[model samples]
Target: MSKELLMKVLNHEDTNGQLPWIPFAGVHAGKLKGYTGKEILTDSAKLIECLREVYRLYQPDGMPIVFDLQIEAEILGCELLWADYNPPSVVSHLFDKEKGIPCKCKFPTAESGRIPIVLEAMRVMKEEVGDQTALYGLICGPLTLASHLRGSEFFKDVNKNPDYVVQLTSFCAEYAQKMADLYIEAGMDVIAVVDPLVSQISPKSFSKLLHEPFKAVFDYIRMKGVKSSFFVCGNASYQIKVMCETYPDSMAVDENVDMVAAKVITDQYNIALSGNIPLTTTMLFGTQQDNMKGVLDLIDSIDNKKNLIISPGCDMPYDVPPENTVACAMAVHRPDEVRSMIANYSSSGFDDIEITIPDYASRDKVYIELFTLDPEQCAACTYMVKSVTDIYDEIKDMADYVVYKYFIKEDIARTAKMGLKNLPTMCIDGESVYISIIPDSDELITEVTKRYNKKHDK
Candidate 1:
């Protein structure tokens, strides 16, 4: 069946409508408008403007209003280190910093931190696009939100002190219900409960710790007469069958789980299944042709229209090129267009070109190799390159320094030779010390200084 017909069946609408393609645009929307993830989320105007641009480009059937999971934790006093290419990861957990997990967790009001910003954005989006599009209000699920508040301790709490963990998760559930109510009032059509961390726990643990809170949140959303979806990212294959029993209107899984397998499980429960496409590998790193083919492969694999919703496996990378996402959306809406694109598609290195790094040992000066796929297009690569460049500027004159930026696509051999596992890595004198995470500037300086001093001593 066609994507449009499939979407209609999933939405419980007439068969004449087209399939609903919802791309989890998340932090990528921030990059589209030249704002960092933190800036885009914390400011209502920026978030609205960014999402409007996303709507114009993707023409999605449904779109998430706000995708930041840190809103609740930020309001609860957890510190975050914002990224230009990704949603800010929770850096400091409040419960960890405080003496202990509070007996009673207080729910955050709309006036708290970024909550007002998200709500305002939702309201504006509803007024502007509600007629044509289904607006999704994304909230971190109780288990995941509790994890953010208490850190890994929450996981241990589940293993060690089950009763207290249950209380904490219940508190998070109440907060989610309140947030869902607020979003329903703002005209959201769907409330998505995203608890990716649940994948880490065993099914027994999930049942004991999350089942009640999960049911409460979904039940509350249903009571309010709004639709609900549960989104989980990571290796959730083990929990897919059990997750279906939660009775969400829809369940979204990431690339780690097989869609064909998920369809069978979700079908048993008669729940809608969305996703399993590799966002990082196919959408973020792969070409438009790659995305089109990948999505088509997934669509062809699923059996029933009522049991499927085509989408990215998880939230898109912040710097994923807009063209790729637009291509994926178009492919989902118009399979004929996808067929045409695939027929004429050529395997050209348009974006995946590589760069060559000169041998620093052969040269007299110190060498700084900034290995990247494409700093201009890749957010993580851009920051990694910048962090090294900034450090270079601080100590360039002090040493005979040479900085070269290498793109992996153009120089696969160099990348492999360096034994680099992640993109946007830094190499000093052919030794790779920094991996995926951004290294501290002072640390980089110290390492560079040591390298220079060691060379002089030799």
Candidate 2:
């Protein structure tokens, strides 16, 4: 709860103890105690009640006081569309030139917006939990705050108005300091700057527009003598190097980025690394055996430097059965028992790597399965599937290959079984051939024919 526990590990000091597990549950906890969305978020008493339940149920060593990223935006004049289960989404951007009312978009103060409500909640929670659990204050990152202020234009401004974007982000950095001050004052031990949008920009653009502003925030937090972490969701594979350079106490990545790659970068910086328990498949939908197997595999993959902390990739999804999280915790506390349960998992996701094809000495057909998030709804998925269909039709009669396309959301077990991570993946003969990129007609034909020709080998 203090610098001696999670903070010591994050600060890279000699803790000589186990690292903590902090799943970003936030509003998701409302599901456990049956509190409506507004009540859970707005009522301090309800917030306290939720905290007790979380500690009792999950026993997370560290937890966030509130994960509502919209507080700053709302204070700046943006409207929010609340959900019953999850935190509200920004319905209006306050600084977009065309859609935003620019005059209303200004920097917020401690007294502005829901800041008072949040500070009060933190104050109450801190008194309630005291030092028994580490408390985190998740301030919206500059890039993500810019997205709330300016909407999608924030992404474009990185290239279109890089200088202006930098200035605006600097303004966000100040707000981050204000929020951190309030949280620290309320007894928060960690200030996590959660900027889930940083991965959306090119690495070069991230350096130009985001790196400095983020450093300014981290530096300010360091001067305050509190622990800090940078949470970037999505495939931040491009921004990983630049992320470490910004000098956070720790860098928390998501499931989209492989822990192996994340470990290499975080180790170089000598910072603690946290994340990415499989949010949907392993934690929400999968069985205890599944969580144990996946969590153990993830735990074994990273270095035993005490830097790796296991947690869900992003905010824990609502409706995620408590049993799954308990299973995750079991993996932490009872590794031997959990490891033994691995043999019981039937729907082993990546065990498909051992997929063996029966001797195809005489078979004349190539079996292909196209995996997508949602081909009908996702534009890229739809296009990728179309490209495959177009080429397959051209050589369907000449080459005996059959394809079946499916949406990942429609089946988690199926998606996991294929060991597919990226969207718009095409698996031919038990191996992913094309991933995230649509293939050229010639290239597609060559690969398909190569497989089909092997079938007819005399």
Candidate 3:
């Protein structure tokens, strides 16, 4: 089938358009609006506002009403550690070794933690952009929700007390189905089950512990006559064939799996496949031209658009810029335009610039060195390098350390020799220390001081 026919099937519309476009703009939306993942998720009004901005900017064919996977877990008693730039991490699993497992896990009510926030956001999005965009309602899949509530124990439990694990997953499935029903009633076009943790489990355990529960969830959505999508993140290549066996109308995966292979499996099963983009490198950090080129490459590689959705591999980082996402959306809708833009673009003022740091070893003072890409070009890299510089300046004389910065573009051999993975890394005495994100000032000082003392003592 052509891309148009695939889109028609997705929207249940007349068969006359291209394949559906879905941008998994999770926490990235928060980043665009300068809000933390926790704040954006916990406040319905904020989430709606941010998404409204996204809708206005991207004009996507479909979008998830709430991109968070921890909502259901939060309601089930998991304590979340909220962050300013990223999604809140599940800090405390209620069923950990210290907490002990409960006899029964009950279904959560609508008023439970974060549930009401998500539902309200969905309602607002329905009222606002419901006519044009296919709003998706993302709920934690049974296995993932169980993992958040029980941590790694959920995996161990699958092997030890298989029956109890079945019961727990069954409860989670019902919870997910209930959440799906609520979102569907609120005007969501698709129900997406996000179970990233399942990538870690064996197919045997997944089949035994999760397969039935997943079937139950999908069956409930099928009964409602709504489309259901299964989303997984992480390296799940081994589970791809089995995931197709679950029979979701659509499946979305992250960059860890090969898209071509996933496409083959999904096509064989007649299930739609979406995504496989690198969220961290491509969406969060890459340039607009880079994003366009990457998307076009993927599009050219795929022979079948009959069941495909274009999207980022997983939840976006909170700091991902809005313009990059807009660039992606534009590329998806207008490949010709992207190509033209790339061709016509000229190097900006900061291009091809070389930066260097003066020798610090000859000086009598202790010295701190921060290596980064040009700050004027990369905001994230700039901030990270500045963070290290600021800490060194604050405690310079007292700690006997001088601070210096070196741009990566001018020092490729040095960067490569340090064996760094990402940009804006910190190095103390030629030893690469921190990666992309900046570390706390005091903590960095303490670490540097310890290293300095050890060197002097030796």
Candidate 4:
């Protein structure tokens, strides 16, 4: 019945019905059952056990089969750096922008790399929860998979050779289709193209480079009689309208976007929408009351609650308290009761914390600061950091360059101090040079060189 409610909401059929709650449990499912990220992701039995635990605890209306974006990348030959807590990060790429697609890289088969493990898990979960909860099969988005295959040079190709990017992304879309087909066969109710990288580019770039490829994947999913969702993780407010134009059944966003405003755009196309809960501030660090109040406030803020599904900004962190998630579920299930419980409740705000910022003009050395959500876990941040690092050897001595990762509590405060709004930003002397979008190597070098010359009067 809950799964039917969710599917009805996704299809925009039940306007007056209950709003679904999808936890995006991903690797966080493992944390619920005393399993590590590496353990549950690699083991089918463990993965199943963990997911069962999640269903028991959260009572989610929907849940993703697996949250790891690197499944396809790993199969296509990208090496990964596995972690105990979070999903694994891709550590190597198979293709280079200048060299073109690697001839040795072939399409992934159902027998290839971890697909067997995932398919096995999917088959079981469909049987276990298919009656009550909508199951999501998340495929790495076209641009993100292209970045995994082509490395940081993928962005360079976007500016210097768009035709190449189109070719690469088109190829990636085929892989996405294949992955989607596999999940559909394995009994996925919803096929989500998890392309966090799209949040980094402009709407124009998205249209020029990714429009058809994305549309193709979603269109194919539609033809298969399965619902589709386009999920992006960063501050993608700028691309919402264009994203809706691709015509996925739904669009899911992270904490960075304003749900009300995004919903206005999504509603224009009659696409159902999900998400915008703050992952760190509310889910991970805040109390149960905080979670409840956040959900209630979100529910209240949206004038049209018809097509909205409340979820964490992105993947749930590994350590989010089970009770906090329950609070969200409670608010969704029992809003009036929750409202009275939190009638006078207020969350402790971090706005009072002091943050020291860099003195760009007074410093003698050119300061190059890179802000990210940890380069290790986020692919967009990884490649954004890579764009600078790839050119570091060439500009190391030419300028006083330093890269700082603002992923921790203190650094998050510092990010606020620097007036940076987006993750994976490149700042030259405290000025935001690249926001979300990765810069070309030559552009980065030239900007750094100009800044260095101005600093030393060279």
**Judged by lDDT, which candidate is best?**
4
lDDT of 2: 0.72
Give the top-scoring candidate (TM-score).
Answer: 4
Name the better of 2 and 4 by lDDT.
4
lDDT by residue (416-448, candidate 4, tens digit) is 788887787888887888887888788888888
Q: RMSD (Cα, Å) of candidate 4?
A: 1.8
* Structural similarity to truth (TM-score) of each candidate: 0.74, 0.77, 0.73, 0.96
Cα shift from native, residue 58, model 1 (Å): 0.3
Candidate 1 residue-wise lDDT, 1-458, digit = tens: 13244335455554432456888888789888898877887788999999999899988878898787777777777887776666776667778534255434456667767778888999999898787878889998998778777765554577677887888788889888878877888889889998776665677888767788898898899889877899986557778776767778899987657778878887888788888666655786678898888877788777565556778876777767899998888778898778877985654433444546566666555677766544443333444555565456687854443333332234544666567754455677777765443464666678777877777774
Model 1 lDDT, full chain set: 0.72
The candidate 1 region of ten consecutive residues with least summed lDDT is 401-410
What does candidate 3's lDDT look like per residue over 320-369, in tens digits? 66777777777778877778778755323223444454454554445555
RMSD to native for every prediction?
8.3, 8.3, 9.0, 1.8
What TM-score does prediction 1 earn?
A: 0.74
User: Which regions of candidate 1 deviate over 4 angstroms?
Assistant: 1-18, 97-105, 344-458
Candidate 3 has its poorest 10 consecutive residues by lDDT at: 401-410
Q: List the residue pairs that clash in candidate 2.
A: none
- TM-score of candidate 3 versus the correct structure, residues matched by position: 0.73
Q: What are the lDDT scores of the predictions, listed in order?
A: 0.72, 0.72, 0.69, 0.86
Whole-model lDDT, model 4: 0.86
Order candidates by TM-score, high to low: 4, 2, 1, 3
